[model samples]
Every structure is written in C-alpha cells, then in structure tokens.
Target: MQTEASPLVDKFQLTEDHDSVFPKGVPWVRYHGKYNDLSINIVCPGKDSSLGVDSVGTVSVSLLTYASVQALHPDIIINAGTAGGFKAKGACIGDVFLVSNVAFHDRRIPIPVFDLYGVGSRQAFYTPNLAKELNLKVGKLSTGDSLDMSPVDEAAILANDASVKDMEGAAVAYVADLLKVPAIFLKAVTDIIDGDKPTAEEFLQNLAAVCLALDQTVTQVVDFIVGKSFSEL
Candidate 1:
C-alpha cells in the first residue's frame, strides 16, 4: 500500500559488481558481514551509473520500497554522498563526517504555514548515543533543487550551526521515519561551496573518496543497522 516497489523515477539497470565485499556488489547494494541477517542498500545521487533519482524524497522512498519488496529491509539506512562544508569548522577536503543532526533552515511561515508549494519541512536529527558512536561531527545539511552554493547560503549554513550541506538528507529522513527505521548519513566534504555555478563532476568524484574519519563513520553506520560488515569496530 505504501507505493508498492519503487516510487522512484522509472529508470534503472542492475548490472553486477563482484568487486564489492558484500553480496551482489561492493556498492549500490552489498551484504553485511552478518550471517544472513543483513545486507546494505547503498544509494547515491548524480552518479551516471546510479538508478533513476529525480529528487531527494524520491530516491529515499524508492530505496526503502526496493528494500522492502526485495525483502532486504535494512535495519539501518545509510545515506552516503557529497556535501558542501561550511568554513567555520575548517573541514578538509575528502573528510567523512556522520550527520548527527539536520536543521531545515529553509522553511518559514510567511503568514502561517500556507504555502501553495508546500510547508518548508525538517528532518529528524540523530540520537545523542548515535552521535557519540559516530564521533560527534556537527553539520548542517541544506537541501535545494540544485547544487548552487552561494556565499549567502554558506553564511546561512554557518549561521544555522551546520558544517556541511547536501541535497538528499532531508528526503532520506522523511521516508526512514515512516518505516520506523534508523538512518545515519555519512557525507564526504568535497569543496567549499560559494555562490557560483555548481560543478557536478567534482562532487561525484569526491563522493567516491573520503576526507574525515571516514572508516569510523562507516563502521558506526553499518553497526547501527541490522547488517554490519565494517572491518573495524
């Protein structure tokens, strides 16, 4: 009833990547080191090889749907991708920080929550215990239709006490809550985003690498879920 199978854009091709340590592939979808109790459903945006993803909400919902339909309902949902880090924290390029909280600084009730487009929304923040496990990297995740990071936006993120901004964290939290599942965001800081024409190529390449205490974040994410295959933890 919850929009059977995937509510994502109708486009996808599941080839095989045996190069992964998990089951079908190392990424996209992988098996947890657990003995048949779990596997990971890794999803990314803006990647040429990734399946159809029109918006953050769509991708998150579809991944959840796919997991349920395929009976791969992961105990935890991990959102891994690239984000623009605010300068306040001196975030290094390729650093991996776990999202402990997501503040929706875009929402406002001009008069009183009556926008025809929709009410600006917010996502559920991470638990304090989870934060401790993830190494306590506070960040702000900004969501928008495009990757345009302006100085004004950067200032806004900094003002909101955010360390990084992304397009999908809000959507992922939106769907994960509905299914009552836990989701941890593992984001890699690529560059200092300021008001300018955003470059998709650079962002995607950064998503493929790391810069922060990455492995720990990954382990914490995997351990939080039903499937945990992190080599260290």
Candidate 2:
C-alpha cells in the first residue's frame, strides 16, 4: 500500500515515500514514463503541495490552463479521487476501482407537464479498452456535491453494478468530451456513507487516496503499460 511519490522519486529514483516497500537504494521504479503513450501531465486540484479545493470555476480554469500548457489532446484523461461508498459491498474500506461510468446522484428532472416525459438526463461514459485489460474492477460511479446519504441516493447508486460515488467525475467527463478526449475515472472507496457502520480508522486520508487503493491502481496501470510493450495493438 503506497501513496504516490513524485515522478522523479518514483520513476527516476530520486527518493521514496516513507512507507515504500523498496529496500533502500534498491530503487523500485514504479512509474515508467511510457504510460500507454499518454504523455500524461497530471494536474491535481492544487497550487503547490496542498490539495486546493479548486472547485467549480477554479477547476475549469486550472484544467483548461494545464491542458493548454501540456499541449495535451489526451487520448484519455482520468479524474481519480477518494469517495464515500454508498454500498461498499465486495469492497473494503480502501478498495480501488475503475469507474467506467459516472452519474449525478442528486439529479432529478421534474416534469412540469403531466403529458410531457421529463427528459431524465445523465451521461454515459467509457474508458478506452485499456481499462478492461488492466483487470481492475469496473462499475458505475455516481457523483454529487453533498455527500449523498439519502435513501434515494443509496437506491440510485445501487441501481447498477456500481462500487462507489464521488463529486468531480461528472465535471471531468464534461470537460474531456469537450476536448474530444475520453475522460476516465477511478475512486478509492473510502468510507461507507452509512452512519451506523464502524468508524473507519483514520486510516485513509480524507482527500488523498487510500493507501492500498492507490497501490492496486498503480499496479493495474503499470500492467496496462507493460503489456503494451509487446502487444502494441
């Protein structure tokens, strides 16, 4: 289980995370630059080392500016985050997931007219085939501003083969589609949204990923990249 280290530390052997399993000086380089040809430039919601909320307007401006700077017309852009699980079944407190689709958990289109079918709306999202080959668990990921704890919210997420829920996924999809790129997503299932569940050991960081979750995710992405070494299809 590991949180991410800087690319230089993780890739170029510059340093290591405190809990890194690697023997000192043995240099476990987990992040190889050739990430399915992503040429990825990650821009988390932040200014420096801190996780800036960068909500709404800030998120838009930052992403646009970063994308422009990287000259990245990405084939895939992923918005990975830690999320509270409405139903963390077949999941642990820190299970990592591949989110193939995300919905607005709080969305409801009211029908003003009795005769008119209120167009209930949500987005259908998919990762490139790469996600399937990564062998990570994939499912519907619902998003909303407030932590969705209502019975309706539980039912909405449970209405599918969903694993978890979050906030930023829908926005990421909107932006990536606008840029003509596939926006992918993942969530490290953090806490059960249920109030009665055993209090989680302040084990997982609030915004940063759950340790085991991030490790598994990185492993999957690494396998995806390594397989491309020969498959190149």
Candidate 3:
C-alpha cells in the first residue's frame, strides 16, 4: 500500500505526519500539509493486524473514510489508486482515468429491488472540465474485493459498463456520499484484464509505472482544483 502511495507522498512533499492524532491502536497512516495553499490530508489504511499486509478492499476503505471524515471534514475525498483496466474500453497500461461513476459488481443479491441495491451504483462528483482539461479518460469504475475476476464478476462488470475496476473506489465514494462530502476517483491502469497475460503477472510488471502515472495525474488534478469554487468543478 505504501508502495502505491509513495509517489504522492514524494510529489506533494506531504511529509508532516499526523498519524498520532488518532488513537494509539488505530491501524492507518495520516499526513497533513498544504499543497498550493490548500490543506491536504492523505490517509492510507495501514496493514491488517493478523495478516500483516495492506488492509485493502471495501471494508477497510469504508471505515477509514468514515474516520477521516470525522477527523478532518474534508471538502472532497480523492480516491486515487491503481486498477485493472478493460481493453474493450480502450484502456492501456499506465493510462489514468477519472471515474464518472462507481459501483460494486461483486455485491450480487438475487432479488428484485435488492439486486439493484446490491449494485450500489453512485455518481461521482462531476468534473467534466477537469477531465477535458487534463485529457484524462472518463469512465465507470467497478469495485470488488478480489483481484482476480471470475465469470460471474466479469458478467456483472460488463453489465455495469465499467472501464476500470479496483478494490476501494466505490467503497470510499459510498462513505463520502453518506457523510455529504463530494468525492473523486482517479485510477491508473496497472493491468489489462481482457489481455492474454495472467492478471497477477501483468499487474506486477506494470505497477511501478502505473503508480508514477497516478501520482502525476493526481497532482495535476489537485492543481486544477486549487483556488476554484466547488460550483466551478
């Protein structure tokens, strides 16, 4: 997780650690500083206690987002990370996307209204100008806990018309929406799920480059947001 977050840490010089503001036992990292006169807070759900790895997925992101919202009351939450891209949607390795909407493809409930509820689709804060100005692709993003896609998940993703998929974007968006905070998702493609290469192999091979792309793109987005009214976005 830190590996994926490293580039932003370096780029923004977000070096003032705020990890101690939380309880001693809290398992997350927080850094607060200014980027071009706008206060910025970067929170990363830390390693899981038992497994000793990044606490990724919907659960962790939801909890972390709730906690961060309570603590900082940010105007907007930016969910920036790496994701699996769909070649069918014209995604290429290292391409970064500005997610227009987010949904949960893995949340399958077989009932009538519940089936729609299970999808949990939510619109991300619209930033058409930002997308156009940055020349970033605008797409729908699907979230699921698993890194590997299954037949069922694939079908659900296709139904959602997702161009990119990740573990935490929709979860964060859900929490932000619940807390009445606008949210944006910026995902860089780490692997092409539709490609012939094994998912894990491709993800590992392209992760570093994708992280760099994510960092640069996020910086640009931040720069664009600075000094602009929320209505302008």
Number of colliding residue pairs in model 3? 0
lDDT of 3 at 157: 97
Q: Cα RMSDs of all predictions?
A: 8.9, 9.0, 1.2
Relative to the unseen true structure, what is the Cα RMSD of model 2? 9.0
lDDT of each: 0.51, 0.51, 0.91
Question: What is candidate 1's CA lDDT for residue 132?
Answer: 65
Q: For residues 83-117, could you state the per-residue lDDT of candidate 1 as single tens digits?
A: 77755576666667666666444443346445312
Against the true structure, whose TM-score is highest? 3
Per-candidate count of clashing residue pairs (backbone under 3 Å): 13, 0, 0
Instruction: Order the numbered candidates by lDDT, best leading.
Output: 3, 2, 1
Worst 10 residues of 3 by lDDT: 15-24
Query: Which residue runs does candidate 1 get wrong by more than 4 Å?
Result: 1-37, 43-71, 103-109, 114-130, 133-136, 150-159, 194-207, 211-216, 223-233
